[model samples]
Target: MKADGEALVFYENGERVGTVPLAPLSRVFMRGDVTVSSSLLGKLGERGIGVVVLSGRKAVPTMLLGRPHNDAARRVAQYRLSLDPDFCLRFSRAIVEAKLRAQAAFLGERRESEPRSRYLLTLSLKRLSSSITAVDQQATIASLRGVEGAGAAAYFEGFADLLPERLHFCGRNRRPPRDPVNAVLSLGYTLLHAETVLALYGSGPTPSSASIMRSTSHANRWPVTWSSHCGWRSTSMH
Candidate 1:
């Protein structure tokens, strides 16, 4: 692929294939073996367009983030906020609460649509509500994570009820998803995570500064965090 003025020109077997306007594009996803020029990468970075490359069957992703907001002071402040324990705790509580609420709403909708799953959904909803309430009571990040994990466990129970029996989905499992439902959910969550990082980079905050209720991966060490509240509503709903 090559950048031609304001567009990306595609080629195949030494023949021109198609053209896509770079202006309308926010991010680019390239699978295994796809290649592009360094000049195009620079152009994309200049336009705040992130490029994510996925390689191999596992689809391990490597991201070339766009140029972030130029406000150095803003980034500094964000870094400071990330380090503040009180702020992180408060922010994490809010994030977990929003995630649980979204889960509850999704389960409630499932209950309405699938009468046969109402019992399971109702139980999950109640569990989520309790977790939401407990979010305020948590003092440390570890405890908050526990609350979130329990809520997610309950939420997945309801999610399992919505899937077809053929999928044989009991609960959330990943890193080698044993079932179809888990596989799709894992893929959706991975995409959501990429989008979240892009959004954060676009807004000038370092995605690594996203230290609230998230861990640093040993592989790339790109401090990854997902907008799980939005994920439950946008991803799980579909």
Candidate 2:
């Protein structure tokens, strides 16, 4: 990859593959064996275009943030609030409630078309509603997590009925997804995570320091890795 005036040119085995204009791009994601020129990197940085490099396994992600926000006070405030139990509890509860409601709504929408699965969908919806109530009533994060876990299990249990039989979506399996359905789910989650990290960096908040119903250790790793390479600070709530 190299820059030619205002466009980025791609090369493969010394042969020019194509060229892409930089004006329309917000970010660029590259993977596998690829060579990028210093001039292109400089131009990309100058244009404030982020580049994300995914590992060969396509699971790990490294981000190159362009023109990171220089707000020290906001970072400090986020760090302080992350450590507060009250803040974490309230924030996590609201996030879990919203998640459950969304799950219920999805199931409710599917119920209209799949009459045969209405019973299972209704059961999942009832479980999700109970989980939402539990989230509101629970004072501690641990209890709320339990409620959310139960709701997720119920949701996935009925997931197979919502899909066509040919898809073979037995359950929500990930971390080396066993089936095609799991593979797509894993890929979608990876993309969503990358997008979320970009959004957080663009908004001036540290992704490592933010957690909503996610394990602190697991959630902090991505931002830590990204910040280490991108020259950003890594701080966590836990």
Candidate 3:
């Protein structure tokens, strides 16, 4: 299936939803005739799981929506900024340049080593632990940019080759597949990280136990596409 399946769906009994996912899940698509109870729907929405419903032959949608996240408004604001005439012109170019430079750095480090792509995870972990000293690049642009988005974008843009673009903050939709910019925004990675953090945060039993439960529940409730969506597929979706 294509990576971004539109919305998380609920079926009459979620039978179609039960097909085991391929791996590295991303979005949940609900079909078949089923009604999500208020409580269940609310829980799904709170997870910020995008929902897409199909209509009968009548050509009317049964339901379609996105759950409002606490940070949704803030996210929306960032999108507006990304499209700003000045920002798009300046930042987009800046991002492209930064990404190129980062890829160069990553490659240079392994000039005599293995392929640049294979060493990405090692390079990423190294950078993640690298210390950051105080510095100013574009004080004005930094001030205008959203803190989270800016930091995320700058680092990933710079290290485009090393990180998976799935982790980039594309907002609304899944990051474009194989997009140099968004390779870091892979939803699968974020989901694992969140589960781990939640487990630790609970201060309950072993984090792994909670982690396992939550991850499984998450998969069942809103299975990210088990298969990585590389775009374009056959009718069989294999």
Candidate 4:
């Protein structure tokens, strides 16, 4: 890719294929060995556009942040909030509750449509509802994670029932997703994470400030997927 004044031009086999205007762009995600010209990088940086590079089979991410937001006060407030355990617990609890409720609702819909899976879906719905009730009672992130984990297992129990037999999608798995269902889910999550990072940066607070759980490492990390909420996946990318 090369910068052409106000736009970026794309080439395939030495032939120009397309051009994209830079004016309306906020972020660019590049995967594998794609070549980007220095002039384009300069232009992107000048326009305060973020770039995310993904490499290797694991698709590890390297983020190139754009010019910082001017909302210093908001950023400072978010960082301070992140330090408060009580606040983080409350936020994390709310997130978990919302996720559980949504899962239950989805299962309820499927229960009606899939008579063969109704028994499994009913079991999941009951478990999810119980977890939602238990969310506020949990005082620590670790305990909260346990509740969420149980709920997720129940949720996926029903989820697996809804899938066609040929899919063989018994449960969620990743880190080189073993099955076709998991592979597609992983790809969707990776893309969602990139979009979420862009949205967070485009707003005010840094992605690190959005973290609800404490990391063992001193460095603050942002989750690469909503999988963290499911309690079965890694909380942050390495």
Query: lDDT (0-100) at residue 109 of candidate 1?
Result: 82
As a TM-score, model 1 comes out at: 0.91
Task: Give me the candidate number with maximum TM-score.
Answer: 1
lDDT of 4 at 56: 82
Give the winner by TM-score: 1 or 4.
1
Q: Look at candidate 4 and tell me the lDDT of residue 153.
A: 88
Quote each prediction's TM-score: 0.91, 0.86, 0.27, 0.87
Local accuracy by lDDT, each model: 0.78, 0.72, 0.35, 0.76
Prediction 3 global C-alpha lDDT = 0.35
Model 4 lDDT tens row, 12-120: 8889999999999988889978889999999998898988887788676777777767898988898787778888788788778777777787788879999999888
Better candidate number, 2 or 4, judged by lDDT: 4
lDDT of 1 at 34: 72
Question: Residue 6 of candidate 1: its Cα lDDT?
Answer: 98
Q: Which stretches in model 4 have alpha-carbon errors above 4 Å?
A: 216-220, 223-238
The reply for model 2, stretches above 4 Å from the true place, is 213-216, 222-238
lDDT per residue as tens, model 3, 115-219: 555465355434422311111233443332333233333334334454455655333233234442323334334433333333222222222221111234433
- TM-score pick, better of 3 and 4: 4
Q: Which regions of candidate 1 are displaced past 4 Å?
A: 214-220, 227-237
Model 2 residue 39 CA deviation (Å) reads: 2.2
Q: List the residue pairs that clash in candidate 2.
A: none
